[model samples]
Target: MFILPAALAFYRALRVYPSPVELMMIYQKTVPEPIFKIVIELTNLDVKDRVEGYYNKFPPQSLGVKVETRMVGDISKKALVLTKDVQVGEVIYKEFPIVGALDSDLQPKGLYCTQCLREVEPSMSIKSPESPVYEAVYCSQACQSLAKPQHHNLLFTLERPLPPQIPLDEITPEKLEARRKAHTQFADYLKNQAYGHSAPLLVARFIARQVASEMNKLIPGSSGIPSSQDYAGADDEEYLLADHIERLRYVEITPPQEELKLITAVLDTVLPGLDSLVTEERYSTLLGKMAYNAFGVYYDGARDDKPAPTARPEDIERTRTPMGTSRQIGSAVYTVSSYLAHSCDPNARPSFNAGNSQLHLIANRDLKAGEELTVAYVDVAQRQDESVEECRRRRRMELARGWKFACPCERCEREGTTVGSEDEENIGDESRVEKNMQRFESNEGPL
Candidate 1:
């Protein structure tokens, strides 16, 4: 039996990091209470306190945090408040940490760990046994196993070849209309029977799965559930109806009429005339729900601006900032994440981690105890570099175009200035940032 002082001294002498498993072994073997205390102190944790804290904040298997409603001007808005103070770079929340598998022949090859989205060596990759679209690569077998349960179905579907790439230049009105007709037929097929899976639709399917999972949790005896949309099951039918009504009440807004047309188009393909199955009002409301809450999902190695010119591709691939350095892969609606409202100058930012297919809300700056956490819908990182008028105009235009809201951000309110360009402004000018995003997305493909 080693003395407490001797054990502590031995622990201090070891320069290498110790795994938690090793620490547990040492903890169990330590005879003296003082040596156990030393181990606890070294780990920087009070297990009892941590266990209590977690149970106090959340129910068993429940996600933590609460949504609060507050009045901004005359409108009541929802915001996600932190249950505890988090330090800088600490993740407040993480959701959908994994996404659809990346296509093989994707550029910046083997950039991310298939499991954790951590950068992995190309030499370290292990291929999925028989996957076609995904040459699934992971940091380790453990990661591959962790991803298998949630990702297996999608992976099997990707065993077929991906459709041919569409050129960005060929997105003309005529071409779009033709594709729309073909897509409508495809949607009908999807409605009647499951055949093919597209990346964007896969994201929607993922959201439906999440919604169904949440619904199952809320209901009794819903174990071993298969699928949930309207008419999937009696329990699911009730949940879907109640969920939409609840969403409307939570957001406190009516569905925008303009978005209904897009909804109609989507429903035509996915549900194949299911648009007429539901009431027009109900269908429109669902579209509005999606429009208001959906977030753009991005994956690792999507950003071109992140890597240093001399940085190796592997080094560049590791960058996973909350606001993302790359183009978006797809969009999905989250029940809890949707509570975060938009701010031009945000205190928090959302980062999509593809490893776990989760979105993490990170602190952009030090936050007070009760600060309503806000995230920017538009990238406002360049505000400091640009003029106030330029910032205001850009934000206003973005808000109008993307969010369907006028600029009411603190910066816009404070600046109260606008400038217009006399010449026709080409928004698509091939700037360095634009070029980088295009190159990265074109090479890697969307999430």
Candidate 2:
């Protein structure tokens, strides 16, 4: 049976320490321990419940998929399995992003709808003239309306950040000017400093969305804006955005201090204490999660004209895309799609057929009912002038560098042994999970 590591760790900590004072010291040593404890307690109501009812609330059957625990060389991991057989080209599920951001270069060009990431004609675009910091153009009034309430007002425009039900201090010209200044500074930073990586912008928008969701709850009969969960067919009220995000694994990242300060200032300016929602540590984790799980948004296959990234190869941000990040027009994070594991020869693929951020997960091949669903996180096809061995090495290296995981899928294994290649002998999966999560998933007792 799966046991939450958070509970196990807390139990062991109590046994080892055996004193309330000692527990306080333990909490001090691990700053996020208290927060994790709360998350686990709130989510994991019992020993049987996993990740605070994540699996229970988002059951696989609801989406034509089931999550199964499998052993990958003694490492217990979750896999999304098909509940029923599916023919090739059939869509298994559709999902929308929690937050999406257009590419930095494209944001200034106003070539796409900022909300849906859809191409917009210059004459037909709806421009946000009130926003002093950012240039946001929507393809339609509906997109503009949704974007403002969702995150645009809080992040870019000088509108009231919270719902009318939430009491606010008397608004003055000086205060409005301050808020405008903060938004401009944050927007400038994104435009100038946050190129190549969309995580900073994505994280900023996500935090704003969370605040919006919370504020809307204070007002009766106000749904604010439809969230990604609504599109995914999940009950939005049953779970907070935090409940979904905290369960996902994150890469280690140290976001620039200035970036955090800028974002905090923007939040704080709109509503005092709003900045507390994103502490430095929390901000880092959020950025890491965005970096690790974001999918590149593209249309009509993808574009070939994305400007060459000036950052070092190691520093350039990569999103999950079989066509490569260069081809994507934007980046987005999805709750369910995040769980689809990687494979060099994947049986499924993500499609944006509507020419927007909504993702349609389609089966790549005829899939059995119990077969695991997989998608290529990186481009895995053999390029012209490249040998099969070369292609394998290239994809493996990309996975290792981008995701910090070595491909151990059947295709990689079969090709590795057949080609007698040993170039990647030193490469191994270096990806990590939160300590408590790792312990729980591994079924290991606490230290």
Candidate 3:
């Protein structure tokens, strides 16, 4: 890590330096430490420990931490220790960053993952099959392991990302607005603060980053983000089915509901709005028709009584099913229905992030032709035991703001999965089957 001050200066000035591994090419450096260990500590030690702790007290200290090249980032309390032998200027594994706590309703609305700090990839999300219980979300397997304990290893509901690949849509204003409004409702429910859900906030952070990226491109002269910042993520554990069904209650999709204001305004500047935007059918058929497309909207539709859906894997792939949907940036390819088709058996999903943007599109299934699309904007594993009525109520209050009713799907009726029951007042009326079955909060649980 010495010599070549001129090169170092050039690298800093350029603001576009060599790759991590490429940096190693600058020089080959090594250190020999016999019977030594690289220690990584994530303790609550304060500055006092640094200036006057045992290390300082003993001068060189007995630990014998041999001198070598330090890494890019400084060692924080929660730092990773690389063996002295491990190659430098290379990616290292450390526990993921923890953002916030779960929401009152047991959703993963508070937790945040660093990988998702700036960019929230919808494709990174996974749904749980166990039941409804939201937990912390992460960009990789490492993230999940680091966040499990905080969620109490509870098995509510689930949405686990698989190795299988699926398509996704670029984030848009319509998607943002719809997500915002829904998010506002979800937050409102948290007003009671029954149990915190980090899933919502985490998912929002995950999706919002993508939304912001797209907006900047569409608005050219703008921050690329809308008024609403937060998003309504998956539930931590409950499913207020009736509330969601009623929440998705239709009143002739207005500018407010469709988020036509920001959406249309941006579209007017460059392309057309929904009118010019391909229909759900055409969008599904033609993946590359427009420079960008909304493809779908987020409404309170569900299989167990809420207006929302299960957001299965197949549903999401329909909209982004095309082979390249995952990798494209502008006017990429995906299933049109994967974009707009609502869910009861949702195969797709969305997530929120912290930074600026809101909402994202992720696949839930393999998706077949004509398969209705859906994204699970709520948490799963945690809410497994939540009744349909409770899910509906929660959705209406948290995401829909009492604007609609619960989903009346057969699951909600026979199994009492959702909320839209004759006895809206009583949520306990429904039995808990999926609730008891749900297992892990992270993706591994589903697998």
Candidate 4:
């Protein structure tokens, strides 16, 4: 057998089970005992590491630095208990706060999908009392489970009573109370089956009110109907005014073209500001929105100098409707998103806002607390017993209205490919000669 070097032999001797003390013994045997004793260190890491775990696990008593245990978002030692925007692709163990994150004033009404926070998809939403509203929630059972623990805490805190989200007497989004009151009236009107109550009265009334409102904006004519009435107007008009009400309709009794032009000029200047006031973020190439609305403050201020450009709530009432088609000009105004509410047939829904201030409603039959309310903006005519093709037709109408192109809704995904930039018409026939001929001959259409 070959003889191994003394140093190698010493290291090999304690190869399997090495305690620090054993390593020191090996050093003493190989090196001079005095030198080994002088240099021997309990401070050496390699020797300590080999035996550390064994001592901690098997020994009855141990002396070491105490490691403090603390609750953390992760298994790792470094962690923070604060809210942060999650990076797109980064993975992390994190938590969120759960407290009265939602308004407790309103009664719990509906449900939503926890995953998407939409109401259209069918899903089970936990039904809790509207009062002692502790939790603002998601659309689905899955969302509840996925919510960070703090989100759960918010729910627990909201377990007390609060006030209504929006008061009936207070001004809300455009036509909010008016629409709500009108809906109540319509519901009451529809309650009666006599005289084809469903035919068109509500729509007719809405249109008439819209028209009258516009007429009232003009300078007063002697007899028929005065064109412009100041904010302090007749009892009928004054009765309709909320503290911040602005007109949406008008009738021109004066036929003063100059005055109309002047009013028009003033409006062009004012409206952009009104719209910009609410914009918190950029809208495509446009500037941010009208700042969060201070109700009708701006609208009211503009009217002090000239005829208000906005339609009167009452004037649209004067117009005639197409036969059997009782159409209303006033739009539906939503309050808190009903993603906070769910329904089998939800009366209220989300209406995505548009550039022109017109909004289209969407339906979210399944929603929960804390979800933005969405409505079915798809056409009502197409909504009835309609096939998917019919629904696509309705969406096509919306596209014509200039809505966002890609539809992430569940229905849109099920249908054929949605239109995109590549589907738009070509700018020019750039291909030449043989290339042009080939392009024509090819079965696939040009992008």
Choose the strongest candidate by lDDT: 2
lDDT of 1: 0.43
Cα lDDT of model 2 by residue, 1-447, tens digit: 223434443432232211224344444465365554653454344333434456656644568886677777766776788888899999988888888999888898988999989999999999999895699999998888888888999988888877776678988999888889999998888888445578999998887776676556545555445654445533264445665675565677888899999999998889875665466877887898898899998879799987787887667788999999989999999888887899999999999998999999999989989898999999999899898878888888777667767678888887774643433452433534333335645552211
Model 1 Cα shift for residue 137 (angstroms)? 10
Score each candidate by Cα lDDT: 0.43, 0.75, 0.26, 0.25
For model 1, the run of ten residues with the poorest summed lDDT: 158-167
Ranked candidates, highest lDDT first? 2, 1, 3, 4
Q: Of models 2 and 3, which has the larger lDDT?
A: 2
TM-score of 3: 0.22
lDDT of 4 at 413: 49
- Model 1 lDDT per residue over 1-447, tens place: 445544443233211111234434544564366766665575464333432342133211233355555665544544567666667787776654223333212212566654444556777776665443334567787766544433332223221111122112334465444435544443343333221112233333333333323323322333313321212112232222223222321111243353344334533333233233334444433444444455655655454432223433222211112343234433444545666777777778777654333567788887666777888776565556787667667655554433345545787677764334511232333133234323432332111
At residue 139, give the lDDT of candidate 4. Answer: 53
What TM-score number comes out for model 1? Answer: 0.47
Model 2 scores worst on lDDT over the 10 consecutive residues at 11-20
Clashes of 1: 15
